[model samples]
Target: MSDTYRALTRKYRPTSFEDIVSQDHVSNTIKNAIKQNRLSHAYMFCGPRGVGKTTMARVLARTINEIDSSIDGESLNQTLNIVEMDAASNNKVDDVHHLRESVRIPPQNGKYKVFIVDEVHMLSKAAFNALLKTLEEPPEHAIFIFATTEPHKVLPTILSRVQRFDFKRISVDEIVQRLRKISLDEDISIDEESLHVIAKKADGALRDALGLMDQAIAFCGDTITHNELLQALNVVGTDRLFEFMECVKDHDADRGLELINTLLQEGYDIQEYLIGLTEHLRNLYIAHETSKLYLVEASEETKKRYQQTAGDFSRDDLMRMLHIISEAQIKLKDASQPRIQFEITLLKLIHMERSEQLSELLAGLQELKKNSGNFVAPSQNGSTQKEVKPEPEEQAEKVSEPVDETESTEENLEPQPLNPSTDSEAVGSDGSSPGPKESEIEVEAEAEVDTQIEEEEDDDFDIGAPALITTLARKARASVQSEKQKQTAPSNGAPTETSSEKDLPEKITTEYVQEIWVEYLESLKGDFPMLLHLQMERTKVKKVKGGELHLECDNSFAQKMLDEQSTDLQFKLKEFTGSVLRFNISVGEIDEKDKPMSVYERFKQIQQKDPIIRDIVEIFGAELEY
Candidate 1:
């Protein structure tokens, strides 16, 4: 068989530093060190697998020995001075000592005796100790070069004695360029798109790229296409991934799940599918901010797919989906069924929608209001303002009208009266008052009724308050109504008006004040639903004046919770109601007799109710205590 059948990767391995792909900086530094004759006794090369760690180590060894004709600027069959050792197999202290003893002797013919220790991290602890002394100080002609996929496993003492160079994962473009060069040299034909697929599959490892290329060439013959590469690799193409992403964008979980199932049936690994999906989303996220497609790997076709998908999703939605999928990936390892986990995660991604943060929601509401048109308040001169009143004839007609039987029946079916005394008199089955004790019950009932009424009136007031307050505040600010009316009035000016009218500020309708106050409270409820549930029953809006909103809660804990969230609360309120409302949180004394049981107490009560859990507890001899 020809050499072409012997895997393109090994056939085209880099023979010199310049021939190495995607690691010029590393290569250049090493080459310069050799030229400067400032070579360190020990050197460590670390990076991901197939990113040229071992290849570079071999090249470095040959380069120091002046074996490559390209580097020495001459064509000659040079004898090798470099000695390559596999530390993985020879990991004993004796092997290390033998190597050390050889290292102490000078090269027989070459300028330097370079010992290339591959997978040096695999050396035993004793072997490492034995090698340390030689590594720290070696013969003038000796050089120790270490290469490993995992540098963390190497002893720090060994690491400290060496010059370390980290090799980065090769980029897709670099891998593609290298692959293209190999294709041209080997007289094989492959499309640019197909090359891109191979490079991406390599995931920044040049060796992997070549290995994949070798597979693709064999599987598809010489003229390989993108589809062929995908088929051979068992990878879902970018188009399919984009299609699934679009389904997610449209919130079509079923469609997304169908696509996932199809891919899985096609023999794609669930883990690899997730990785590809994540990368697809990541590309879109980056594309949303940048027009540069190079930031993420892929061909022109793939880039376009990403840009289109990104346009279909908002930044917030995409971020949320990424988070959910990432979390699901973490859970997949321990899951009983990984496919189910993946499907569930995909469903979540599809169903995921953008939800504005509290601040953003408020801001959006405020913006909407600003664009709705200016608010106008009523004029101070009530007589001058247009007021709708029924004419005498209309009032007479209304008085003459008779009620229909349906209307009468509807009215008669009204809710039964809540007679405070009668309701309070009713005895509970346990012989306790239906309500709290007489004095406490009355106070609590009255407070509850007042709070309810206040809330209702506030809602009614808000509808017209914006326009009314806008007109009133503007007029007051401009002093237009007061100044103009003062000039038109009798020479004594406000002498005719009551002294109380002039002294007392324009009284904002109780309804309008209550409405704004209640709306502010509702806004707070949205941000802290749990806290709101606990406080709403016992909380009351005291007053809203000069943009200051006063509220009373039942205890200091509620007050503190509200206070802690005051800044955010104020911002949200201002956004919702367009009022710079301030909060005054005060604790109110509430009767604690009707307070709900604690969680532990509730657990105990539940155990008493359910036979199953109760039996489990009884069998375990568990004790319940308050």
Candidate 2:
């Protein structure tokens, strides 16, 4: 042995453009440009750190000057034509002024003088301004290469002037291949699993992989394995990640929490663990969605494992779990006990149920459409009827009232035909059903809501009724809208709305509007209690005459939010009252002497308003904090 050692990053760094891994598009383009003498005055290499940005810049610098880029050859950095500056440390007007002066001098040794500015985004505003003129029109003998991890921070003027090359995050298999090649070249004995562990830990950074491999070699001697590399790197094992996911999939909160305890004992950072677990879940989700093992970037065994377990989670379940975990992650930073916070989050994920109400409705609708062709012609009495075959659970939940799956809480809502008609009735003068209008559907939706309210167990403030009512109203509106779209498409591009939709009831009363408004507010309070309290609680129905219902908002803010939701609200109202009415939002005027406040604020205001309190404060010379 020569008894000479070098860091793997430097020892195996690509010298030529061809040797650059996983960035063939960049390398080929640069090579073609160089060979064809079609070079830009300034080039920008931007991407994530340790992805061969600075290295590529140096290669370009050498290639332009006809110098060897190999590490074994004379160091390319030593060439007089190439000037590499760390922009982060020297990012000021004076530094850029010096650069401008230097660019003026002609290259003595090479065709061009290459100035590589690493971390170019860190350049100060004044420095960027100073650089702009030169960058826009640089000297013929000077070439500028700027590299940054964040291209977004770079000025548009500077960005527009330069040729930008985006480097991709190297793939895991590519990193593993590179690591294995280096290990073999150095005569190191490491298992394939160990190489995989290093690659996974690198997270698409090839330089990180090399440094990790070097560290592994330094600590683990010539012979290394997966456990040793993981230990050396202080990284959590792949087993824990797979096991934790299994616990989540199984809804075994205890086991999931036990993993947390183990992580704590092992001194793994909680947030870091959460991030890794999230990534692991994402991989499983991808495997589930794509069914491509290669896309997962895991070992064949791990990919197989993911493919097997991925079926346990539907896309909605995975999305819900991700949301729960992300929320916990954000909340964890402020939490006094991170372990407890994460545990609760995991528990939330474990207990989460997918809300497939909309999905079920869509499925039911599609199934109805498919089976509509199988419907037999009407009986002699001229009435057509079709039966739906739902799952056993839905079949068992039969009640006196018909169940519309779109509004079903426990069962998948199934779509029932509004007008199962005879041929004559179906083919109307306009070739559409004239009977059982949207108003009839509204009645069915109301019945569904009433049944849902009756089924719910609630001792606190009749919330169930209002909530189910609003939900049913919204679902009925969707169904009605969908049916309307399909049936009422006009030949002349005019909507074939019913006369009731176009003309309002001639004599609508304020008392009736108030009643409807109260129910609407109740529905709001049921579904969005916080929002109701914040914006809609104090709204007053100003008038309910003609074709419009004018409502008074507390302020302009309430008017704005409610204005955005006006269409949906109008649809709900039309469904609720069986009448089409336009909703208009207006800010209400408060009495100049009467200050508006919340209940708590009003109680404090009352104390300030009392004359006795003022007198007592004056007599005692006491100050009170409310």
Candidate 3:
């Protein structure tokens, strides 16, 4: 190493506020404080490393003492009164005590004594406590500036005593500009792309950026190229990134996996590769999302390349790729076989489009199945075709034909409810109260109506177009009543009756209904499979009172489904119970703990009550955090 050699970080470190990039806020505040002589005795500088935290503290020390223009670089660092302490090394209670003892002494030459402590958060609990009192009430001539990456780790007591200035990360443009200026001033030959690579490698740390540039210059001799800088830094090339993305676009998982193996063979970090891929996908997503390139932090050529590839993917496909990579990265930490896990996740991306297509096809089939049951669907080649128009004039004539006394044409205008407990008992035309004989006549009439309706129903029927079905059902019900009157019209001026309750099942009850419910559910399993997701597995038959059986479901959604299917469900129940039982469905309250709260539901509740949070939601387009 040459004796006169100096690292670029030390040589080009900002000496004045104007020289610091992207730190106008910090610089402006400190300048006003020093100029006005209103500086705090204890001040805290907090931010990420190499964003002018320590450098700002040093500049403040010299400027406050009015020695900034007089002191040279090497001598300024070794000055007596302007003491700089590395808190990482001298963080014990004794070191703090010794400093505390020395704080009482006045400056030998300068008007003020300045002590700058860097990484002050590294001090022990005892050291902080010992320094707290001194920090609160320091000597008038002594100015203490504490610099820390983590201001939160410092005691609140210490923080309260000092005026804290929080520094922000320098922007990429600013960092790049700084690197360019340094390269020009130092007579180094490097392209803009190489400087950007160094700036990105620095990650907002100007010290790190200059250090990287110094290393690049040393390695490349004089002219630093992008490829040499990438090799020197051991980062994967843009070519590899593009190639990997192309493999995905072509849906070639085998080639992608081979590329991954090659990267591993070259001793590249899996995590780096994963991050690089995620960033590339993010750039592509941005390109697809907007016409503006403000958000993208890459060269014009790189942006054009991303733009070219961006159209090759949809937003959904890009989001899926991002999700897969993010999940893999999270799982990669605890994974014993990280490489295998990565391979699986990448292969999942390759197969994602096909899987989504299959999902859509299955969904369509399910929807068709649901609606097909409601209609007499068309057959291929117009097979099973039927023209359901019967002769209207003949039907009207038959309807207008008067019936003889032997067969009563009494039309039951309003159909009686088919509830076993209170079904209308067929009475005589003379207004005789209904008895077992009348009930038997009604039962026989209903059976005949069922058979007649079945023979007329054809494949052209549409339930959604319900005019025909509704008319048919009404006509079937009217025919039953007319038949009931015929049976009870009295043969030879005397009504005839048949066998009664012995032909049907005895007494309908809630207990009997409950017994057959499980069997009914089992029958439904072949049809409405979505009902299996229902939480109300144990629906209770509350009672059979007032002509209706009351059933209670534990969930409102389940109750609604049951109510909608009540006609079909009650039919099944009656087939087992042997009675025309009516039903009233209700939802009962379940335990609050049993009904688990979702984060979204809670967020909705909160949003309803808190208008400020609602406004924040509207302003930011923020969703509920899980």
Q: Pick by TM-score: which candidate is best? A: 3
* Whole-model lDDT, model 2: 0.71
Candidate 2 lDDT over residue span 301-388, tens digit each: 8777888888877765676677676777899999998777878887777666443534444433443343244234557886443232
Least lDDT summed over 10 consecutive residues: which range in candidate 3? 526-535
**Could you give candidate 1's per-residue lDDT for residues 536-574 as a string of tens digits?**
435677877676778787655457656766665676555
> What's the candidate order when arranged by decreasing lDDT?
2, 3, 1
| Clashing residue pairs found in predicted model 1 | 376-467, 377-468, 377-471, 458-514, 458-515
Tell how far residue 616 is off in model 2, in angstroms: 44
Better of 1 and 2 by TM-score: 1
For each candidate in turn, the TM-score is 0.58, 0.55, 0.59
Which stretches of model 2 miss by more than 4 angstroms? Answer: 69-74, 249-254, 351-626
Runs in model 1 with CA error above 4 Å? 1-4, 68-80, 356-626
What are the lDDT figures for the candidates, one per model? 0.68, 0.71, 0.70
User: Which regions of candidate 3 deviate over 4 angstroms?
Assistant: 1-3, 68-74, 354-363, 370-626
Model 2, position 186, has a per-residue lDDT of 88
TM-score of 2: 0.55
Candidate 2, after superposition: displacement of residue 344 in Å?
1.7
What's the true lDDT of residue 464 in model 1?
Answer: 16
Give all candidate RMSDs, comma-separated.
Answer: 17.6, 24.9, 17.6
